[model samples]
Target: MLQQSSAALASVFDRASEDYDRTGAAFFTPLGRRLVEKARVEPGSSVLDVGCGSGACLFPAALATGPKGRVVGIDLAPGMVGRARRAAESQRLGNVSVQLMDAFRPEFHGARFDFVLSSMVLVWLPDSAEVLERYRPLLNPGGRFAFCNPRLTGQDGIPFVPEIFGTVMESVGVHPKTFFEDLDNGWLGAPDAALLKAGYTGIEVCDETYSLELLSGEDWVRWSWSHGFRSFWERVPQARLGELEKEVAEGIDLLRDSDGVIRIPGTVRYVSAST
Candidate 1:
């Protein structure tokens, strides 16, 4: 089951790599930087970014740790690691290195870190507590682990294309797994007690809402295609992908206001703790 899930995750992100950085830049990147910032990273500190997609947090973390410090980023997707490495090279970040590695079973030879950071990742795992416990030993004494994930409160964010697409597909007798199904099956909450059970102290979790403005339904569709909709698209028949995209776009179009801008709402909770 772990191997299958890992393959699915790698395939999803590998296929999304081309547009992941751009689509994620609007939100995921900022959230990752925030997680690193809250970790209180200082110069010469050793930092690890788990599930680091396209260097969103890796670059900022490298800068935060300065030239003397080391920042290592790992992702299950080789495509994402390639993209991140390119960005780091382009920026001449000699202190930062990205590798294709699994977050669930991260291994380093006699290596530990001052801070371990992840963002928008825990929600996809089947067991948040187990993952946290796995990471605990990698941290130095009193080292911190900080991460963030969507809160899923109220209306489960905007665009609403995934649910709509699932409905459309099911109506046609083609049942594809919906995005919410993944959320329902995976880590869903703040994991406060889980952190305690994982031997973490000084745990803090904060909830915040972020408002995003989309120019039109097309924009939202593009972003979704690059992020949340990747798995759905893969499950769909190749010949039916165009139809699905059109249907989802039409549904998203109705979400626009009189001024033509869509107000997409998102809520996330940040978790930080000392190991």
Candidate 2:
């Protein structure tokens, strides 16, 4: 089941690779930078970025580590790996390499990395605890592991933007409660506890809220299909996708401010621990 889920996730990301973080929305890139910041990556460090989609976290870490350091990024999606590799080459980043690899079972020598980072990836894994343990051995002594997850809030127990998608999905007779339920179940309740259980120390968890500004409702629809939310968009039948998008656009437009910007608020939890 885990392998099947990973394959499905890779396929979804592969399909989304072209527009993954290209949408004008200030979401993934900003969050990736924030995670790198929280990780406190330094020059000459050896960094491993798991699930490095489109080099969001990978590039920043590479920049932080400077020319003397080495940054390796891995992803299960071949398209994502290809995109990251091209981006690295285009930028002339000789110190960076992106490879197609499974995050759950990373093939690396023990204690090979000074830092390991992931952004918005753990919540999708069914065995996050075991994965945390698996990643621990990859970090060298005193090395740090850092990652981020959405801090779900609101009456429906999800972020505001996703709540809108759920409501729109239900309007089209496709229930999204199961999806959100699975999401809620997958995210760790006490990430620090999980880290401690995984034999990590010096744990730190922080939360920050970010506002995603969309130029218009149409922009929101485009941004939705760019990231993991694409899964929800894919659930709608092709014949009903247009109808769903139109309604979602209208629904999102209603919440637009006087300046015509649709700002969706979400909180992200960043966690770091030392090996």
Candidate 3:
């Protein structure tokens, strides 16, 4: 069952394809950006954006590398790749390109990057440690590998409904996994200590917790239902789904004050190592 769920998650972003760029960017959590900064690419350096997700992390990367350097974003979903390409073109960024490809099967084909970066996408892979080991051979010496590791953050910041997740599962006689895979074990500690056990060097890891604000309850919940946790919603009871949405909104309201601003707690783990 875990295997099937993992496989589905690998492909699930397709359902959120259309709204991903707009919604994710709007809700673009700060942790991802901080991770990219730690990568510290220089002008003319080559960079790879794994799980690019409509290039949410690419634009800043392009600017970081300047015009001489090139940024390539690879995503498993064809829809995301297409949207990324459109996004690059809209910004007229000549140095960045988006491609549809799997990180597990990196057919870079004639390209080597100075930095290989992934943000919040590693949780789905059971063999992420091995995957990083595979990436080492492709990086230029002194190049860095980095990603934003989450500590069960963003639930409160969500602009849509997730307060109904447990009820949604109960209604169907099932257990509901949260919007994410619950990778919280290592935001401050090594979730995957095996990463260093593998032959990588110059390791530095740290986590920071922060608060993120979203418009209101409904928008946050709707966005989560549409993008962040679509699979959870699909398996939920169809009849009582609206109730779940309402419950989610009510929960969000309770978390707020007289000013009506909803604040969600977020924790980010940032890790970087030399390849």
Candidate 4:
């Protein structure tokens, strides 16, 4: 079951890789940069970016670490790996390298990295605490582990834009709860206990809010299909996609400003811990 889920996730990301962050959406790149900054990556540091989609966190970390440092990025999707690698080469970022590897099962030696970072990726895993424990060995002594997840108030705390889509999903018989069960289970809202359980210390959590602007409802649809939200869209049947688009557009239209743009507010919670 795990293998099947991983394969499906890889396939979805593979399809999304080509236009993942290139769709003119100001989401992942800025968030990635913020995460790297918050992580305080120093010059000459060795970093490992788990689930590095299209060199988001990878590129920024490389720049922070300078040419003398090394930044290795790993992802399960071949397309993502290829895209990141190509981008790295084009930018002449010799300090960066991207590989196709599972996040839960990285194949690097123990204590290989000064920092292990993941941006907006940990909440999707089935067992974030266990994954944290597994990744601890990859970091050197006093190394840091930092990651981000969507902030939720509770089990029902779906963001406004996603709540709009969740309503549409319900129209097609898919429950919104299916996507947030893990988060609702407490790993996302309260991760300190999990970090401690995973043998990490010096934990810090920061809350950040960002505004996402889309020119129109269609832009929202495109943005949704570009990232992790694509997983939600995949559960929607093909025949119902048109209906989904129409309904989503109508729903989004309700939030448009006088300028015909939609602004959705979101919160990201950043957590960092030391080995």
Clashes of each: 0, 0, 10, 0
Clashing pairs in 3: 158-220, 159-219, 159-220, 159-221, 160-219, 160-220, 160-221, 160-222, 161-221, 161-222
Tens digits of per-residue lDDT, candidate 4, 46-142, equal 9999999998899999999999999999999999999999999999999999889988777886548999999977765656668888899898999
Which regions of candidate 3 are displaced past 4 Å? 1-7, 24-26, 152-192
Residue 209 miss distance in model 1 (angstroms): 0.7
List residue ranges in candidate 4 displaced over 4 A: 1-4, 160-162
| lDDT: worst 10-residue window of model 2 | 153-162
Alpha carbon deviation, residue 131, candidate 1 (Å) = 0.9
Candidate 3 lDDT tens digits, 19-86: 76454324443555676687776788889988888775777788888899999998887777888899
Local distance difference test values of all predictions, in order: 0.76, 0.84, 0.68, 0.84
Query: TM-score of each candidate?
Result: 0.88, 0.94, 0.85, 0.94
Candidate numbers sorted by TM-score from highest down: 4, 2, 1, 3
Deviation of model 3 at 223, angstroms? 2.1
- Looking at model 4, report the run of 10 residues with the lowest lDDT sum: 1-10
Candidate 1 lDDT by residue in tens digits, 1-275: 12137777887888888898485227777777787788888899999999998887888899899999999999998889999999999989899999899788888977999999998776665555688999998999999999887775535532233356567667555444444444544455547778888899999888887655677666666786675456655657788878877887677677778997776666778889998
Q: Which pairs of residues clash in candidate 1, taking residues 3 or more apart in a chain or in different chains?
A: none
